[model samples]
Target chain A: MQAQLIALDWGTSSLRAYKLGPAGAVLEQRSLACGIMHLPIEPRDIAGIYCTNGFELAFDTACGDWLDAQPGLPVIACGMVGSAQGWSEAAYRNTPVDVASLGQALHCVRSLRGVDVHIVPGVIEQVGLPNVMRGEETQVVGVLQGLGTQVLIGLPGSHSKWVEVIEGRITHFDTFMTGELFAVLSKHSILGRTQQPCDQFQAEAFDRGVQVALSKDGQRGVLSTLFSARTLGLTAELSPDQQPDYLSGLLIGHELAGLPDHARHKPIILVGAAPLCARYQRALALCGFAHVSLAQEATERGLWQLAVAAGLTQPVTEA
Target chain B: MQAQLIALDWGTSSLRAYKLGPAGAVLEQRSLACGIMHLPIEPRDIAGIYCTNGFELAFDTACGDWLDAQPGLPVIACGMVGSAQGWSEAAYRNTPVDVASLGQALHCVRSLRGVDVHIVPGVIEQVGLPNVMRGEETQVVGVLQGLGTQVLIGLPGSHSKWVEVIEGRITHFDTFMTGELFAVLSKHSILGRTQQPCDQFQAEAFDRGVQVALSKDGQRGVLSTLFSARTLGLTAELSPDQQPDYLSGLLIGHELAGLPDHARHKPIILVGAAPLCARYQRALALCGFAHVSLAQEATERGLWQLAVAAGLTQPVTEA
Candidate 1:
């Protein structure tokens, strides 16, 4: 029942910690607003010393007490916490890497609590446009278990990533700015003027948006189709309440359309927030992606697999 | 020379007034920061009457002196002044409308000074996605005078429009939120965080962006290429100063790529701010669009033609 590894999913705005037991099972979990960008700033005492560093303060607040009861728990962290601006820089590892290869490249940062936190290095694809990812790599590593050779993993978020794996190695990937683009367009652009937020999901409008993205007009690309979000409202085709979901569907559709050609024949796996993944699931269905499924607890599982791969923790045999 | 017509080009952010002599020649002109959205709020006396209406105040300020000198001059206005939110709603005229046709449908709003201002109605294309234009319609009408039978007119700005005119009739048109997207992403998104303003145009970066949009990767759409604006910077391939122009070029390139198939074979005319038009010209060349040209004084010229078409002014014989 004792914890074997402490896994931290630290991102730009939020931090999630998991206490994994024998056989890589999640024993306890905690979430904190202590992501690198919003790290704790208040001076706090840690290991008989006043810790002034934001990373140290955040690290202590996130799981300092979890380590108190069991001091020997090996720590593993992923995401922006290993970037250039993280507690300690973990240089990015090139792509065509797997959990085993990435596990060998984990960066180490010693905290004031006398614990060495192993940080997972983000992946960088040097080919083409040079795509980079921080936390999604770990999630991809977690989801690769027992998957076929032709696998397309989608991690949807502010910057949605479509990663293609060939026999457990991430051979190629693409990043789409759909979510962030939608956010900025809705909050700061002229499109925001007419959008009226509604509680009920406007499935019709959302479907219409997805359809439009697949239609010939959508062939013009999103920059052109985006105007339709407002024009449809002006023409009263889409009510105010339907605008947001319509936009969401439209952006997701465009992102789906932008996926590399190899994704079409592959078995797709989606990992992200449930709501966002649900949106992608709907869009993927609309896209006629034959084989698709959603992943649960991807981050913790990926971190656990990575911990085992790194020899930092061993998976216990059950019964 | 005596002024024959008073022409006002009023839009969302600025107003320009012109006193036209015989032959629709500009005799005098003035510009004011009083577009419909930024109308004057200060109450003032107009023709001995204290008026508080924003439209009236803006109208008086833009050309009250010209009207005072010749109160009998016929007045014509165009742009957002005819929008639903303008002085008086000049209901949008359906597309396939020409200058003569639009002039016949001008809506009249009487000012505090007892002068009737004929406002040009904007054009709306209800086909497909329902495109609408307020100010750009006038510019299109202006640029259409001597153009060929087949014309593809591009007016690039906050919302760039491409109007397809066949034998002087606006048969169809499309709108791209390219300019507005560039502005919002540069000002409010994660991409903006790494951008640094530069006085000089990053021509190389701009050209690279355009190329990327036309490349095989660009076939995936801008929602994907947009990530390059940041990844390129992260990889040290694009500097802070180059990011903005690169994004601008990328958006413009995608917009050009979205233009209907018919545009390639026709003569293309661009009407907008000079610098923006120049950027489009560069992008057009990069896009292999050979038949591209720039226009000047499109608004005032279009307003003058419309006024003459309405029998509000006569072309004086040159002596």
Candidate 2:
């Protein structure tokens, strides 16, 4: 099958390119280290033009070969690659946007290779606390096809995002520093001092942490409960090996606890790395969340849908 | 006035020696950089004995001159100096302890000069979640006199402690890693990337942070609210200089929000650096906490009381 679109998930640390056949089928894929933050800096000739820009260098390295194979392939990219510091700034679109609205708003930046790359605009909510996200909005669009009218989509990563979708439109969302906080605390704070790395999963310790986050003590909030991570070790209640997972569960539990009460009633969809999504699944179950499911290949499918909606590509026809 | 006792506030990063005269009045004082974590390493002759021990070197450096000037003066020390990692291990005393009990239970470590340094044992609470404190216990003891039967004392610092005292006995207490979290987040996390140092305090931003913590949105918990430190900046709601204070107020607000409901009705006392205490004072006021006040010279005063109670030093007669 001939490729219909080239979808790129270009985030802060990694870039993943997908060659989607008709109907956004995965035909070929490539992973590169050159996200916007880590783009190649060496100058090189591209399309008979001398180029030194990191963005152009990264762009060629990521999909230049695929583009050469089929020069007319429509290119669409998402994530921090379109931030203010990215290849080209894609101004954030306000909330209540879906594939149709955001697809129509793709910011195009022509590459030195003479290929126009359509960058998806991120979503922002300003109702109360200003919440923003670039990449997760695509995943939300990807997974909305078969979900209920009201759904909560959780994209867990360095910065976990919980997006609320009503019908097919993105309404509101929240960003949690849970993953980053856990990383920073485990790597730099006193909590890391006693944490022993382990090969086996400390399920009991993790469950205990989730329970603590839901217990009366957790009502005091994470700032107060965070000390338990260290004190529990001092009291010989948590072994050094169990401390890391315990801290993980505690943070994930707190993140889940922050979800709106209505979220418990909505069908929840999670999209992220398998291990992290599994952790969230466990924590959500512990938190009494009943309707939870995981979604796969969200970014490519969302990018495909947006590409089609924007007339960059056509939907697959019946065989 | 002649020196009656030498009191040392020995903590993790710094040590302070105070000479108290009649009625526990300040006679002389010295500050040393050598805390347990940063003790001096050079070999030196002390009291006719060659010593290479870091603890002995730090001990001599802290107040060897004061001891030489008044060889018979009694000495008492509090804080991390009593931990297992300190110069000598002082077993933690369980909670509901008063000055009399802790005073009588001083753990004595004999120095190279043949002088015994009395170390105050820290307090540990075993109820529900375990909580521990070393130096702050002495401060709690110092500020207990003449207060109401039941009062809450807050020691704001790297690890802020909130103690619930009843009739001069520490009944229950909690520790919040607020100050340390703020430091690590500001220095190491993405939150610090946009923060600009300003000589002037951003009171408005700080107050807004406190309000956000107390607001309905804050009910979601701090792990969720922490993202606002960046989002508020992205939206131009907070300037670079205001970001730091805003984060400070936010964390402090969440810490205060964790306080039990009864804390609002009980008298509250804060002890620490005047500037930090003032920040907490302002936040506490914003949180609707009415009966809040500050205490001064808590560590030194508490050390004096404990020394007198332990019979290490005689009580001064009124002049």
Candidate 3:
């Protein structure tokens, strides 16, 4: 089947692309190590080297480069690639937004090669403190379509997001730096300097961390709780290899604990990479959340929905 | 007066030496950039280079070296110099320990040059989660002698310690990796990547962070709230340079919020370097803490008490 549309999910350290059929189904997919921050070439020329041999390119370059290899097609892109630092800035749409509204808010740009490019706007909440998301909004849109309204969605990644979809609109959301914290702490902190080989997750240690995080009644926050990861190792309560999982549990557990009280009773739609999803699923179960379900290909699905809503692609018929 | 004893406060990055008279007054002091981790010489011969002209010495060699230049006198050391990776291991004393008890627990060793050396023991809390402190015990001991019983003391640093001193004994304490977290997040995390020239503290941004941290009711935790540092920048609510102080205030505010209820009602003794103590003092005041006082020369004063307690130096006669 000839490609009808192209979808891209470009983030800090990765670029994922999907070629879709006329029915909005993914026909072929490609992933690259190139993200916005690590782009070897300048941002202006990124579209030129999209499919080139070496430097990984972002959406505009990838789309322009693909069109250079073949012909033009409608392209939908999301993630950090749409930020002020990306190919073009797609200003964030304020929250309490419906999926259809997000479709109208897509930032459209004509590539130098004349390809139709639409960058989905991220969501921002400015009520108490400012919170923003770029690529995750698309995933949340996908979740909203599948799970209907009044559902809680947990998208776990570098910056995990917990969204509240009330009656088909994103009323509230929060971002947790869980994954990022885990990564930095593992590599740079004193707790990470110990010569422990952490190759895989240890369930026992992770559970202990979850328990400790839950036990905190706001009196002792994560700052104090994190030290226990080191102390547990020093006291022989946790092994070296278990430290990573323990740290992960501590962060994930804290994220789960921070969820609004109403979100806990309902089944949360888990999205993102399979491994992270599984970890969140386990953590949610441990936190008394029993009906958690996974949503695969959320980014692609959301991009397709946005493409259709924006009238860039035809809607898929229900199978 | 000629030096009657020598006291060393050796930690991870620097070494400080003080020469004391019979009355325990510091007659002279020297500081070197050498520490346990960066020793140019082997661990065993550190004593011999104490009074040497170069950084090519560890604690033991420096001591031996100092003795070589003059007659034998008792030497005392505290901090990471006695860590497992230091000159010799001074086992951590269990909590509920008296100020004099730490002196008795000091690890005594003789250098190859036959000079007597005493290393003060750190305190360990093994009740719920294991926590160990190497250098802060000396400061806690000093605070006990100066503040009397039933006082709450905060020794802020890389690993900030909040200790409960009752009747000249260190009963319980908590360690917050506030400074370490600030350093790591500023240098390595995405929240730190924003081009904020954070040389000096920005009071407005710092106050905002403290307010946000205090507003968290254990629901969102620090893991989630930390991202506000980035979002506040992205939304133009905070400038780039304000980020560092904002982050500092957030961590310090969370640390203050986590203090035990009893500790909040009393005058908290703030101990550490001037700038960090000032930051903590401001944060404390923002958190509704009044009557905050500073303790200067805490490490040095603490070492003197331990020295006299261990019979390494003559007891000071109160004027």
Candidate 4:
């Protein structure tokens, strides 16, 4: 019997699923906003359709029937579904993750209907570091396979991750919460009161903030420095457009200040959305990091590649 | 003829008005929550009862009222009333303040009722630095008078001020947004979702957070260290009770980390509400500044001294 391959990259707000042939070629692609948060309790019947015909068909209407039609297909899932609050915790495999040695760490979960469901395992790193990426790791590994070795991939979001790949092996990485900070500061701080929606980043303010971060006084003493942002803006000492940029610079500056000095010289590849990723690249350049590039659809692309490697998908050919 | 003295310490949330005898004795004290935010767009005649009495009252009401009631008594106002959003911007008076020189800063102005009012100038210091205190200089001067000589006075609030006084002179000071950071983090961050009402800070967690802040890594990169609070809490590594302490540690840690080396040797005096001041003192002790003291009514007392120097009222017996 020929087996169909289904790949899923599900996260907090959305989900992307793909169907592939044996050779890992994409046969069809589908996506939905039905993240883990939207799923109904005891959604076994609905979830079954998600694994087979994709979200185009109503999961609630024909999930069971769709599952029956694709009885022999193998399903692979990644992303937040592995979280404690998601489908179930996908037990993590500790780093350094050897792509070839990587195993299909699937949790054979039994749904409310007693149907067996397998969920992929997440990768855990830096025992003391409180960050764990589920779906993104698969994509990172896939990127390594697609673009041969020695790349630094930055996955930016509420919790931004920078993954290091050396010779096709997932070596080490770090996580920074820049996105979340922006959200909090823009909405909660005194800065929030005066902040307006403008894309302009005051280069001068960013430089000054970076200089402050680099000061012998250091970024660790930054809380007191935030008041300077207001002073700089209101008093015309710091340009208004620069407040956001200054905030970004301070955050990025601290990130650099805390980093192991060795990480500074490495070739960097930013894997996230534009504007923000561009901003990180700009800051890194200011900090003297010379080599940096960006990757598009890193998460989805990584998911598809991982699904293929897991013997669950076909290789895609140009349409 | 008898002269009445009035002093007002107007902060963001509440207005504290003191009726003082000529000798700087507290005759009566009253407080109201009608802060600047509660004031009407146009000033109102709200002092009908007190003015009806024969005794002159030195209350820090609206600027207009202070002017209207000016000729009869000396009115000294301190605190946020000097910020740009307040009645007027008081240029910061730098440290090593000569209270004798400060006493000469009284300005005469015509009131709305054609009365002559004496407006005390807000002192400015360290012209280039963002460091400035409007009313706090008077309070710090009072603290110096009451405590004698060199001391570190930490005033905690929406904007926490750390002032260093040397030999009765205000040397230098810095401000930290501890209270504001706590409020923002508790009400707006991802951590806020898990926050419970934290009326009394959990000492253990606060201590632990202080330790975290004391980390070589923590101090060097605190701007980034904030994320650890969320990660630690969300991962359940840190208890919910520890959130506030962690936050307090972040703020206090940054303060301790950024403090000028000179402040380390000075005896610390905390000036604020009982609970918060005590907490700050405790945090300071943990940070190795063990010699700490608390000042009650530092704001009110500071206001009185400034009021007396302005000759708002004649010396009366100590109440």
Candidate 5:
């Protein structure tokens, strides 16, 4: 039987873990609604456990029982589990780390039940730019392993990250809180309640916001752009759906405004959710990034690769 | 006993009305906790009579009989009262309007019986720089009279306003949603609830934030600056109280970064709550602004001044 390797991607709103075979294929995938952000700080409180559909307990019980059933198996973890409030802050290893070097002993420790556990070290790009990354380090490695060339990877989400890979090593990176800005703007700014959830195209307002973002004078600061959405709506000019897109344009525009000097002509690969990934692809294309493409579920795939590097899974060719 | 004109400044959370004598003196002042935002859409639902302890019930009963006494008023209104939910919106007279020429005639028709109502026109400066103002226009005029200035003025609040006054004439103005950014950054950003409220000077984390804001690089989009506050607190060895202030500094710094050039050299006047006002005052001084000072309840006094201008009160000699 193939040995078991556990790979997890713990996000703010969801938890996803995959049990991998020795050949690195997913034997079974499990997820729970319990994210670290929702957990009560008081360890005694089981509120997250109760609200979650038996996933956390089941994960622990099943993994523990499986380990008992078969001794000498090791499980490795990554993602928000390594954040300060997570399992523990996975001390960052400064970048330019080789995939072979990532073999350095994973954050190995014993669980409450005395089960041997290994947590991956989140990468910190402190040399050129002061940025921290957890699961994406594995994703960059995976992309590098698959691509076999220097690449510009755009990891989009609450905090969209961009990393530079040269010769299978992550040279440098920066974290832009793009996705986070969209969340606050949509949920708390004056335009918060007005952002209707939809995938429909808000071509018009987005164009306007993009124009503003592209302007030399307008891109100075984006906080002012939010008020325009309210005023435009009040004046019967902007539609409800357009509000989110307009805000998206403003944020993406600001992000683009600060793009690294080398990024203008670089090959852009997006790694995140579908709509957002698509939006970044389009925004970059508008900014003359013609080689833009999507990197699907790179975070999860990244964690799995880290598992392999941690000696939890056997290396297999990317499908 | 010349007929006194009562000036009301009713908004989302507070209701304040002023009793103006034939000679513009604050003969009496009354305030209530109920604001229009707290009331439901139905007019009848807002008709009940309620008064605070200090208010005379008999006098309230008479006023109640006059205008239903719940949310009672001397009657001229400004602020949110012009929104779709507040009193119906009064159309604006576009820019360069004389404080005397705001020509913001109230929607007298929206009042209940015996409530002779006039809701001021919310100013709209749509042409060049594009800005709209509702309640602040009246206050600007009042402060102008109070200070006897035909100079540039600033009003810092949820929306920081910059009004251009040339010889008692408001040439043009613009609005910046600065306070809203602070609220969103503190409550909704990834740093959500991480930076809790603390006394202004008592916290060192706040000073760190201010330093970050003053930093050349930290002056970029505030979203990026916000994450640093948590990072600094966790890694840089800062006290808890200072975290919130650092957040305030980043937000205020972002506001100052985008402030108009013309207003920077002018005598800057502030009109708002103390702490927020004080924060803006601090921001102005730090930004190399030469002259900055605060004005007392300028909006209320501005409304009172409007009453005098409308022949509702006789002008008093300069005190």
Candidate 6:
């Protein structure tokens, strides 16, 4: 079973390349820390002259670099790697976007190595204050394909996205810096100074954080609620190892609390790494959302759908 | 006139010394970046043997180091310099506390050099979850003295405090990590990567941030609203240079928005460095608070009042 297409999820810190079979199943995948930002050459000059360890390289050389043991397949790339600062600037597609429309808006860059390359355009909400998502849109599209209904979807990661999918189109969405905030606060803030590293998640401490966030009745919200992580430690109610899980719960709880009223009552399709999805699942349950389902291979599925829709790959028959 | 007493505001990052006249007026003042953390001696051995640049030192050496020309005067110190890891562990005074009670709670350490030294006890709210304030209590006391009535006081800094005073007593208060959040985010987060050095505050950008925070209608609060700083930049709604002020406005706006509903309707007495207070004043006005007053010499005045209340200094008549 030879690889039929390459699906790339290129972000700031890492690059994931999935080799998809004819049936759109992930045949094999490779990941490297050499993200867009790690490239030796500037994004503008990446398409032209560039060399890595005495080898001449083009901007699209990532596909070649990762396919050392296999032949190069047609590539479909998403995430920040397609931004203005990426290999080729793929203009953002405005909202009310669907998988088909996103496929139509794909930015095809001429590959120097004769392999076809297409970059998915990110989605932008242009009404009022603008909000944009690059890599998450792909996963959202993937979830849309699987769910195929009006569903509230949450893609949680460094930057979590909550989208309202209505009739297979993204009607509205919001991006929360919850993961980033948790990272920054835990690593840099006073509340994080005493945090001891732990391998296991402390559900008790996490639940305490969720309870506090949910029970908040005063005008004091996240800003003040955050201080409790420190106070709880100082008062001996929380231990050093418990701080991380508690902080995670607090942040996730706050994010869940902020969800639009309509999204809160309904079941949410959560898409992301298992650990983060599980944390969100717990927080969602605590926030009164009864049903929270997880979707696997969201990025791969979405990229595959976009590839088929864009005529870059053939539709795979079901088993 | 001879210096009657020394008032010290010793914090995590810096130490300030004010030489007060008989009436508690600041006759002369000095500051150094050598805060408690910078001291070479351990908190336990601070009262014993220590040396700075080959000279013998003690727990009260900070006052001695700064008072090279004048005779050593009795000192009143406040802030984190009195924490468990500070010069001496001053106990926290649980609140619903009055300035008189806090003054009475001052921990006077017997100086080896025979100089009288009193460290003002910090206030702790231990009813539900423990919340503590060190240096701000002094300033709140000062504001209470000046206002002599019920008032909502905001002490803005690394940790901003919103306090309620009735009959010259601190009835309740809340702490916001706004400034610290701004510092960590701007210096460490992705939104801060494009920030450039600028001396002047960008009012237009700041107002935009405040407006966005105020206009937030969905479940997305600060976590979501913060992304606008990045999105607005990507979409060209905000520039990199304007990010600092805009972030300030956003955090300040969120802090103001989180204030107890009753506090928002009343005028707030803001006490802090001029620049921070001015920014808060602007944010408060934008958030619909009609009256905002600035309290000058808050820390010094508060320290003086504590000294008099503790009977550590002679009460002098105001000119």
Span of 10 residues, lowest total lDDT, candidate 2 chain A:
A94-103
Please give each candidate's TM-score: 0.98, 0.98, 0.93, 0.82, 0.84, 0.93
TM-score of chain B of 4: 0.82
Candidate 4 lDDT, tens digit per residue, A231-319?
66665665555677777776666565565665677667776669777777777777777777777655545555555566555555334
Positional deviation of A43 in candidate 3, in angstroms? 11
Per DockQ, the best of the predicted structures is 2
The candidate, 4 or 5, that scores higher on DockQ is: 4
TM-score of 1: 0.98
Candidate 1 residue lDDT tens string, A26-129: 88999999888898778967899977899988888888889999999999999999988888889988888765688888899998878999999999999888
- From the highest DockQ down, the ranking of the candidates is 2, 1, 3, 6, 4, 5
Chain A TM-score for candidate 3 is 0.91
> Residues B199-296, candidate 2, lDDT per residue (tens digit)?
99999999999999999889999988899999999999999999999999999999999999999999999999999999999999999999999999
In model 3 chain A, where is the ten-residue run with the lowest total lDDT?
A48-57
The CA-based lDDT of model 6 is what? 0.80
Error of 5 at B135 (Å): 0.6
**TM-score (0 to 1) for chain B of model 3:** 0.91
Better of 1 and 2 by lDDT: 2
Compose the digit string of candidate 5's lDDT tens values, residues A1-319: 5545666666666667666665566777777665666543323213223323232343363455456565666667666677776666667787777654665747765555445667677776544225677777766755655674668988877877788877777787767787777777687766776566657878666767766666754654776665776777667677777778887877787776657667876777777778777777777766766677777656556666766666665676444
Model 3: DockQ score: 0.71
Leading candidate by TM-score:
2
DockQ of 5: 0.34
* Cα-based lDDT at residue A285, candidate 1: 92
Candidate 5 residue B299 Cα shift, in angstroms, is 1.7
Two-chain DockQ for each candidate model: 0.87, 0.89, 0.71, 0.45, 0.34, 0.67
lDDT per model, in order?
Answer: 0.89, 0.92, 0.80, 0.63, 0.65, 0.80
RMSD of each: 1.5, 1.2, 3.4, 5.4, 5.3, 3.5
Regarding lDDT, does 2 or 4 come out ahead?
A: 2
What does candidate 1's lDDT look like per residue over B1-319, in tens digits?
Answer: 8888999999999999988887778888998999888988899898899889999999988888888888898899988888778899888888777655887888899888899999988889998888999877788778888878888899999899999888888888889998888889988999999999999999999999999999999998999999999999989999999999999999999999998777888899999899999999999999888899999989888888888788888756456
Q: Give a tens-digit lDDT track for model 4, residues B196-230.
A: 55677677777766777777546445545666676
State how far residue B109 of model 1 sits from its true place (Å): 0.9
Residues A223-302 of candidate 3: C-alpha lDDT, one tens digit per residue:
88889888888888887888888888888888888887788777689998898888888888888987789988888988
